[model samples]
Target: MKTNSLLLYSCLLTMAACAGKNNVPATETINALNLKKGKTIFCGPADKQLGAVSFKISGNGKVQEDFNMALAMLHSFEYDEAEKAFADVIRKEPGCAMAYWGVAMSNFHPLWSPPSKEEFDKGVKAVAIAKSIGKKSKKETAYIDAIGAFYDVNAKDHRARCINFEKAMEKLHLDYPDDQDAATFYALALNSAADPADKTHAKQRKAGELLAKLGFDKSFHPGVIHYIIHSYDYPELAERALPAARKYASVAPSSAHAQHMPSHIFVRLGLWDESIYSNTIAADAARCYAENAGIKGHWDEELHSLDYLVYSYLQKADNKRAKQLCDYLNTIREVHPVTPKVLYSFAAIPARYVLENRMWKEAAVLEAHAAGNDWKKFPWENAIIHFTRLLGAVNLNQLDAARTELKTLTALHDELIQKQEAYKANQVQIQVKASEAWILFKEGKHEEALKQMNLAATMEESTPKPPVTPGEVAPARELLGDMLLAMNRPAEALEAYASNLKDRPNRFNALYNAGLAAERSNNAGKAADYYRRLLASSNAPGADRPELTAARLFLEKQKTLAVR
Candidate 1:
């Protein structure tokens, strides 16, 4: 396999050289010949296939291939492995300034969360070491300086530093227009600095356009394809990224993150089977990598992929698989180097299991801080636990318990606001208002309850989901439909569910309940149509979710009526 890969890489390089002589773009020529699926020529460890990446730098001549492999790992967001690869390069040649730069880059995850204090200090120290080595070419210096901006001590915060870093990368990209590394990293910086509230997706669109110029369809560079997926992760832009999403895993199948990243688009498009396939491989890959590396506990990537897997399963009405995942989650006693991603996944998986299944009593009893992680570090994640519990309490008419959960949610909301996490704070506020509305309905304040619920739904509809989560624990609009249904307003309930389904398609609860609402409104035809959709989307053999059963019975009854 290695020999074959090397031969393919040689052929590609030869083709590019020939194309350059003929004044033709190499990527376009390669695309024309349909040779775009070739693997990276440079070999790293047997298990780490991080697509083609080459960034020439002033490094030990023998370590250049290793350096490129490290850069590829970094592009795939396999930070731990990338850091080790870079460190190995430094051991081989301590004067390799670019190797030190890779170490610094590994510590700064652009899209996930800001570095911890320890990570920040490590990045700063690595940058200092690279600067002290100080014999880099102009291009290498530009790369170092761009990353250094993110570690600037005088910057107000991570966000401010992100903007500074983006500006620096923009300059570097402009200076080296022919450099694929510069363009790919610059596109990533643009996405990292994007404002989530900017519904126009201006930064995202710019990033996507920049990636497109790199011949995204034909380039085997993992970063090019990976960043393209992220650049188009938004609902409005998801379809544009479908091709990249479908192609990324094949390009770098050995990277766990590469396997998982495609599901971001899959989930957005409500492609449950595709998402399940992606994350299933990703989770297993993560586990295998950890075990092979002799790591004692789960990697955060494993948990992250599992969360996506569980979510997709629930959406497909594959409750048996979803339950098995929840069981698997419970067996995990530890995750190595617990980051925000790990915490969010640990908290979210169970919350999603209960809420998605509508196991109201189970949700009511769900414990917070159960993972033994520091919940205070992530108020948004903590709020998910409380919000799920609140929903359960409200549904079960446990008014006092619902109010208690609401109070805790309000406190978390205030905490997020104080931290200047406006997006998360707004999300928590929606939960608070929804919980309050449900509690009011239980108290017989029907008009007031409906009004408050509507406002919450609107607020939620305006807020796009963060990239970290599969979806909200319970979407506020769906909750509004539930409230309307409970109030015996089936027509209004159907409208609410229909609108929510447009944004979040193929949801089991929404589909089943939408059908129920249609039936209650005396629209048997519409109800049957919804039931058929539900059945078609969820064909898990022998899977018997009550909702699926209800849908089946409804359809059968309709068929009988037609025969009569």
Candidate 2:
């Protein structure tokens, strides 16, 4: 019943550790610790390496069935079984590594949708586990290290692998000098361990020093050059990084990791003007690569590049280009099947589209695409996507669906409680939550709507301080705008919406609500202006088609009011 039953088979390590053995049988035994609902079972975190499992599993046990089932599902990748299993795992072991990893590896992954604090905590716990599991012997340590590497592939626990790799590098280089691929592995480990800025600059410096010392670039690893770009005081190094980046990009243009480098470098160097060019090249390269790269790996980089293209165009203030990129992203869902990443991207379209003219119908269609499906495909994003979908339901006056969404909200909150993750809603999720509240407000359930709004605001206020991304502020302001608009306080909503737009004008949530806030305020001229702007925005490319039809209709009705 243990969430993280480490079940270290140390006694059997003698047989399995032999380098002569190619395959290690699943340790012959798994020890079970009886856990029950409401009993606080401490599965020791890696920090707590009581050499025990983890204490953060919380005292509750309802989620045991859920976590176990999810493990089985992941072993099979049976989407439905994986979804159910993951949901239960999170419900049972909210703070355990298994829950986060299970959900991440599930048919429906949390990070794929609207990520929750719960999943992040579980991820953190998983990382802690990797760090804490102190192995006594060489073989035991290697096996533990291997398992840790296995868990770190997911983004949430991704940083953990970096740590483990760095440790491995230290051991191989300093402890056992004869290890194979030590330098390459060491450099790779540093790339993950180095502070982004420090890593980049240091690599360039090291490359230069190595060239000077050895009379050539003896460190021939490609990634060393990739990390050196503009992160530190190495102009020569960064210049070198570009070609290295270009070379890798050329060879594996479809690799999301490869393509992400050069564009990110250019963007970080304050080269906005060149971003569109870079983004396009990388996106196209990635797409081409993905298409031709055989059948095994999924096309993560191509989709990521498409997203970057959308953002790049917006930064250049090129609405047309942004729209084109968004359209491409939209079509990906239709072309690809249902992975968590694909599905969440599918839902994000409506969230952004709402900012355009007003395609209540179009938005509904996108939301419906995810309806009754295994939203569990995206655990991290469940909160965001569900909240956004609920907004579409409210916009179309599907009160029943709106209520159903609230139940989902409750379940998600319960999950968060289990994980005890800090809460501060991302800008987009807040807007969606507020949008749903506005719908509730319109249904004459003013108090209920206020409670919903309050919950969102509370999350914003109470969320733990994490490093804010540059565009992170947009979601909260937009949500406040919707809440104010619903309260018949358009003037306040106008200010909130304006602030949100000014911070991230490309955000669809803010753009869509700008017109609504104006209309309710009876500022006919301002309303028309917002609608026109909405039509021109890039977040939702479909705006020209029918998104603004409703806003246009309203403007026509208000034409005579220009008498003011």
Candidate 3:
């Protein structure tokens, strides 16, 4: 049945091209591309398999295909490519109002950080141009107005503007229930407007329901599947998105974002192999796209993918690949547009490498603001470096150095609060508390250390991780477990490790430490179970990591005892 759908879709595209209509009916396109779990039909450029999308607009038929392509790119968060495609449509037909809308839409990434000042200006200009072209259909006007809400100069607050845009999209979707584009964009807006503090994930769940109702299993619309993944990108809901995560790359293989997006769910589920595969391809695609586009340095997508790649590889104890990636990252002199995404990845990749490997001295000396980029602009990113340095200093027994790092982190945390970045501020606070806890532990204040560590862990548990990172640099709960283990309270340490693992499964260090804690507590069965899990999670053949070796020895001993 899936094969038949692919064949029918190909035939439809061919028939449309041959007939010179340049327009495939939306219903027909959706029905023809209703692919199931199987082989994907590659229908376009090798680097541009944007699954079928038909957003019929009042424009020259000659530019219809280009418009659709741009729309698909927009859905996949390929902003640069989408902007170029929209520009091409405008060049061919100056009166294409919706094309201008597309350019404006490209500048406003709903799920990403708010546009930079330059990008915001560009979007405002595009919206103005679109409105100036007065002869527009009601549908076109609605689309333009919906995007215009985001570019509203009066609405300086990005969140408020996002809410307004969501309201606008809701009306548009209601007015045109049959329009797949309207429904998809509406769902995306809902996801974007979702309150991060709301543990219920009310808006995300609603968005997921809306997308699912659009026939996610059968619909080949990249945005539908992509948004479904975003809508369910939470720990509690991640499993529900596994099917979509498994299928998204196949649907839009050309999109770096599409390839990388699956890792959000994959990381949440601790599916390291799947996450690694997704990020490796995504990083390559991003590099290819950057080179082809004549971009001066790395694209943000490439850096983003590399960050995830480093994380997944480290999880599997593949330090060789992670080190190679770090070398590549070190060689990068610049990024195309240094957005928050790029900044986060820049800070995280190295931090993850040092912290994951537990290279204390190396981490202690790690530089902050090493790149020429202005670290002041992103206090949260700067905090990553300080946090890592603090952790390393504490481990190395450098009390003064740890306090200095902690002081810097505290200042950065204050800056985050001043910027009204509540979510980022909360994250930094967690780091601050953790750093203080470790410093206290080193100062021989075990009770105070545990108290601070538990506070940090509680705060971390209450906050859902943002989609930008795979996981925390060092989870506070895991740190608490480490503190307890160091205090020789193995039973309490084991309990803490178990709790942390429940939230963030399959972390190599966590697994090994949990096993060690259990063994020390004389729960041999639990120790063996955790040891076996650690071995299973790390698939690197013949890996001689001491942790891996220890797990192997412990498990083997348990097996021998069982046989006896």
For candidate 1, write residues 1-564 as lDDT tens digits.
224433443554455445444323333432332211212322233766678987887744899988998899899997877887887776666667788689889989999888876677667656655554545799998898899888777678789989988999999999999999999999999998988778788998999999999998999999999999999987778999999999999898868888899999999888999999999888888888777766688877898898899999988878889999988888888788677778888788999999988899999988864564788888988888888898898889899899889989999999999999898899899988898899999999999999999999999877778778888878899999999999999999999999988888888889999999999999999999889988888777777888888888988998898999
Question: Which ranges of candidate 3 are over 4 A from the true structure?
Answer: 1-47
How much is 48 displaced in model 3, in angstroms?
3.1
**lDDT of each residue in 1-564, candidate 3, tens digit only:** 224433433454454334333222233322232211211222225666888899887865889988998898889987877877787776677567788788789889899888876677667656655665656689999999999887776674889889989999999999999999999999999988988888899999999999999998998899999999999998889998999999999898878788899999999889999999998888888787777766798777888888888999888998988899999888888888777878888888899999988999999988853553998898998899889998888999999999999999999999988888899999999999999899999999999999999999999998989878888989999999999999999999999999999888899889999999999999999999998898889876555678998888888888899999
* Overall local distance difference test of candidate 1: 0.83
Question: How high is the CA lDDT of each candidate model?
Answer: 0.83, 0.45, 0.84
Off by over 4 Å in 1: 1-47
TM-score of each: 0.89, 0.47, 0.90
- Model 1, position 55, has a per-residue lDDT of 84
Pairs of residues at least 3 apart in sequence or in different chains that clash in candidate 1: none
